[model samples]
Target: FGKSANKFLQKCGVKNEPPAVKIAELLVKSSREVWESVGRDTENYKFILQKLADDFNNIEENPDLITRMKAEPILLGVSEGKKYDLDSVENIYINDDVVYLEIYNELSMIPKGYSKFLYECLGCKSLSESIKEKVEVSGNTQETKESQDLQKKLDERAYLFYCDYPKNFIRRNEGWLKKLKVKGIDKIEAKYFMKAKNNYKIRPVTACILEDQEKCIFNFYITLKPDYLDISKCLVMYIYKSRKSREINYLAMMLKAPLEDLKYSNNDANQENSQCGVDKTEYDPQIDQNSTNYDSQLEDLFKSLRTMFEDCDHDYIYHCLKQQEEDKLINVENHLMEGNYPKIKIPVNPYDPPVTIKVGKTFMNVIQISQPSLGSYLNENQTIYCKNIKDYSLKFEKFLDGIEFHIPKDIDKSEIFSRHQNSLNHFAKIIKDLIEVFDCAPKFIRIFYDKSNLMAFNQDRALFFNFKIYLDLYKIEPTIDAMTYWYMVICHELAHKFVNDHNSEHEVSIS
Candidate 1:
């Protein structure tokens, strides 16, 4: 035997030197700590046997294919708060320590087309079967019932390995978790409920981790739907084990960090990096289409902005006006020194429209009065600006009555159309929620243009207002910090609709 084979046998606690194949079997059965000892010594073992072992163990406990089969009806039953047909549940005993539930239609109940997708999408490991066959090849010619049962268990494990191992492996290397955090930029919490045609709803637990230290974010999602007996168990599992389930556990191993320690890794580095003004061209949406992982990307962008404006904080609207002032002052000083435009200086009015406002330039829209007045100049501009009005629709009736405003000409229609798709994607779920609550849909939602100090216009409009997030703020922090801007915009705009009714007055203080 070779030196690696001898070391493998010693690490596995086998006497003498096992054959090359036997050594491989022992290595497959060994724990990571044991395998690491051998792995450190030589690269003879190509496959990650320890990971495969984990894959097998994970399948034995939570066979994803089986779990998915069970999940469908259970999700339906729980959503309806009724009993699932017992025929859909199956209990299979593979061996002493490997008992798993297989979900399938009863003899009378025919399997549906969707079942195929579920089955295919779930576990499908075959390598473990080869490993098992290799291990038991010497004496398994009898084909007894016990042997058949063992074979069945091994097959099940193999299928599961096929299903989860690749995903687990990809997630570890490609930074899937990191991507999730980016997807959920402005959303603090999100609930993913999948509804089948039959009104069966599956509540999937999702967590988007922004692991800055690891330069990755983990967007973890899992749905477990077990019938009556397992419903409580599912809930219990979610509470105690779901976060640390095999999927996440394997992911943790790949990250080289424990689940608990991994919390700090969440997007803080991305957030901080974004705040640092190192590079802006890197995450430009026009240049990189794959940059649409909004959550982490936005966070990074805002972090970049924070880095640019040392006095400002992550929350965009809260400190935007101050930052804008500082920016204008810097520009004025530059102009004065270079003699580019000695006459041009920072505006005395913080929210005044710029003399040379363009469609894409960034600017802030501030109603300068100390307090927003319903009857004063605030309401006058609305009538002057909006020329085409047949009758006030219920959507903007109250808002129109409260405000008079003129839309800025600098707002670009093309830019609005271009950015609108993503902004709509950002708030689609929230819009759906509102639609459900109100029981009505508007004819259209219009996104306004960019100003000199802020990329977009006033976010106060009928039923909704749209605006652009300043690129400068994003340039500083990059991706993670950019998310703060999106959230602030959403919160500020939504507040108008949510805080009080049309006639009711609330303080509209803009800092």
Candidate 2:
């Protein structure tokens, strides 16, 4: 175990523990805490804890794995003064510049005020440069090198911050120009120009120039759609001029051909006729081919531009212009969950039809069932079985009559029928007790016995207990109790109704 494991176990109430027992105790305590917090039985938690324990032991033996584990921050689920599940934390990596952490899933178990903790665990400011150096010295293949190059370009081009466009604009020269300031840039000048003939709009162009120290740094031209509703479809042309050559070159052109037609037609005397006759060429075959090739190259340039600016935050420009105020701005955090436990509001009436509500950070519908009846098998013999059980033995009479259970005798030929009945009654009582402990009882408890060799399942507010496998096993094995198994299955399924997560691991832990 490393310093992180030691610190976590201490936080989880496992202080003064031997070094050999520290890791095991941490896994067990954390998992048990998580299970209890979610109002679930800790049966399934053992599997996850055992796996983590094995991994921890393996890492201790392997020097390289131990080093990697130490470098990465352990994500712990903290609730009610206890930590649970160290493996639940996603691995965060620092980029080459070390300016930000690359968090893959933002909804991961990174607690608030843990940024400093992560930095401490990482130990070094930057690991990206070392990783890159390793790859280079080891001789990366062509595909790996190409991918690295592309990623480098993307990283270099990525913007640090984005803003929305201003709301107010006065249309001049059939268009308008809006000047805005970027954080690092000294001056950014923008213009929107339109070309119209015979009351028909021909060209809608947006141009921007960025300057620093009286020298132009970037020039951009965007050709908007005729309606201009879909900003995603707009064509953008970025021009770059080299300082050494004093020559201008196109950096990229997004959605190019449509804009090219407007560009060529705008220069012609008769815009409508020239645009219509763009494909037509003079009778010299070789000259016509050469001209066609040049046009093809221009279209290729536009396509290339799309790739260059594919990940660029164009939405920022639209947002900046539309909002026009800093206070009204919205970011990715507005749409994502920022806390450990999602804020869940359970209605006063548990039996009411599930209503759509915000759970955690996201909005979702939760289905609640009140007084759910057990399946047909148990319901069919409810009156007859209750009467017979009362007459058969006074010992079983103490159990609540609210729950009805049916166990098929054919499940195990050697087991007595009365024993099966007694075990089921005991199981139902345990479930009720567990529910009372958690204070999350449903409207009703229903148990159905089936010989399909299936596991017990809880669905749509009802529990179907398989008599063939689960019931028979509980009778045969003293270690396997009906109460614990039933509680585990019920809690597991109830969590699904609450959060609706499809993840098996999460479902297992909750169960």
Candidate 3:
């Protein structure tokens, strides 16, 4: 029957077959020899092998080590009857290729390969496989999926020991099995071993990514070896959690959606978040328009200038002028165009001979050497030759010079096609109120375009004050006596300077 079975096995194309029965006997014999070499008792040694097999079987079925007693075999080995057991086996020689064991009142030998198989049967294989699986799992989703596939292959390998090994064949290789002693596991130190793996530290949310419109959030878990506890796990966890919470907060704000709106999965949350932003755009046409405006070519320039005057910290007029000088239409000019103050044509009087007025300690002389040679009134000529912008400006300057040179009492202050100082006084009072309220003083103050309604401050010795002048151009009126009645207009400019100076000094001190 045996010969017929062998012929049938050959006919079925059995290939590369090894002697399994002989290998099993060799494994058992070698295990006994190695154990007895250290003077392990016959009965106790047998019991340990059986217990190890049972452990392997249990691991194969359930694979949970939480309730397992790691101390059981160790306590048994060190008890009164088992005292000589470890001591006796202390010097048992196990070389790279062979393990020596004592069994049935005799020493026996087994090859290293069979010993390695025995080690697997003794539960070290399960532990080794578990550790390997944990190591292979990178915790990165992309890599983890690949690892899971590899885990299936490992499971098939595991089936070799549990199902494929012959029924009566138990591998017992003491050398390889004894070598599988990680510090905590082999020594049975609960504190050290308890932290061997951090499966417990994993929260359910660790596997999920919570996201809103602004950010994607994920729970992070770290498991570290004893050596890297400080820098790797503990420290990393603290920093990671703080950063994640901030990200989530910012995301909630950006989405205009509550945290509860975020889905547990990041992909779902991201899709929903995108939809939320779209919905917001749809709700407010103005917001969408603003967004488009923000993306325009002049974005940076517009933003800087659009900030409130209070928001501008440093008085950067000189800085802006310097930028303008360096590259004609570069940084500062870009800002100028963006700010809608593109051209600054310096104001010159229309009807004055060019006169240099030097500012001195007290009252200064506004000397006008010449006036319009063509006379103040053209009786019959309905058409006047304005000629060009330059000549037109010259005439305008002459007219202003004539006004400045005349004293307040000497000039026909009321009858010169103008309203009296009544409205100017009210406007001046308003200027004083604003100045006092804001608490700022400017060095040089002026009312431009015969309009005392608008005031200008020279914050720095630069041409950039034109921007401020442009800003208030619409609010001002073209009136001749505008400055005469509004003395507080000067105070308003002074107030601007005071506020700007305080801010500039504060920023400098801080830096």
Candidate 4:
């Protein structure tokens, strides 16, 4: 209904009418590109394609969905050396006419208006009296019995979908094709795998039922043991139809693309937008907490820095943070010129300890960085500066070897001691085990209360070779799933110590 739709319709020369037979022509052309030539008797196939297009138009469905389904490699059967993939093995159209007709009707992704046209193409009479006369004329013949059996099978076949097809077919999986690589930031490919439990039992449920595009009935997860599936690995199962009995009777599964690819792409996008920066110095960790002088663009800079740090695109974020420092210097210069503030140069050595500076009678702690590293630095720096570690960990008896758990001074320790003691102990054990396994060398791991998500890593890792990690103590509750998830996040950050971006090197390090 927009430019993409309009352009497709224009190419088909059907802006004022249903796509009709042109849809079949497009399919035949596309099929030639992927498989051997199909639909030699194109005129004979016209009735079904025309009818399908008219049915979709009559139902007011977007023409794109039906057209896309027809063009994709959907049919599969045991035929040649390439065994199950019809889209890849050449010469699949051995009996072009029969297979062409079968393509329009015998599909799990069959267009809503297609079967009736297929019925007509089979030369069934349109009206009841005409049908009765035809049945009588062909009564009890072998051909009639065969046709009747075919009709019964068609009626009994199930049509299950497994994707939320975006408009113009964006991110739509090429049906049955094993994904060779990971792609798409908005959604994933390899549509039909279900989420599995420890036992890997599966049940199909309708997921993503868009009114006109597609429906994903993801009720099964045919995977190996749950232990084999790592959360950090981002496992996906690719399920496809195998033509064994009639056609598309048996389903086969293969594992494909990891979800870490999504995070990598997301970080790439963030770098493009914020142009990447990092703090080359440590700060007081509390300077910008209650400050209201920051504008929206500056706020975006802080947000970008946080996201990039989390994403592990360190170099790009370092440049962005450097720009932030330069802006602060310009402001400081203007203030000193107006006699509103004393001139002072904050050290940028990055190894310098935080020192107090006076501004308008306010003695605020500032990390003399390349002059600024601000609030986001503290938010993720892992040291909550809470003097309450010994008091809060009264209930956490299992002491970590290389980790110090701290509750930010702001959180009510008494409530945490009473309510979240079990949770703290549960997550603390996970951290301890992960550290032992990965040889993690962080000085302290802080559990602080944040709004939604949590992160780790000190703003300045150079100081005492001290890397710190922060966990959102109250972000997610103490559950098996939550523990598994945080374990992956923690491992991911630790992996950054070896390699930052999720590349082959990072993958190997994580592995």
Runs of candidate 3 exceeding 4 Å displacement: 1-221, 224-245, 248-270, 276-305, 308-511
Worst 10 residues of 4 by lDDT: 129-138
lDDT of 3 by residue, 190-271 (tens): 1111123332222111111112235433222222222221112222222221112222233223233333553334444345
Each prediction's number of clashing residue pairs: 68, 12, 27, 15
Predictions in order: lDDT: 0.27, 0.31, 0.26, 0.30
Best by lDDT: 2
Backbone clash pairs in model 2 (N, Cα, C under 3 Å; residues 3+ apart or in different chains), count: 12
The TM-score obtained by model 4 is: 0.20
* Model 2 C-alpha lDDT versus the unseen true structure: 0.31
Worst 10 residues of 1 by lDDT: 92-101
Model 2 agreement with the true structure over 348-436: per-residue lDDT tens digits:
32112344443342111222442232221223322111011111110112224465554454444235355565665555555555455
* Least well predicted 10-residue stretch by lDDT in candidate 2: 240-249
**Which ranges in model 1 have alpha carbons more than 4 Å from their true place?**
1-407, 410-444, 452-464, 470-488, 498-511
Residue 307 lDDT in candidate 4: 40
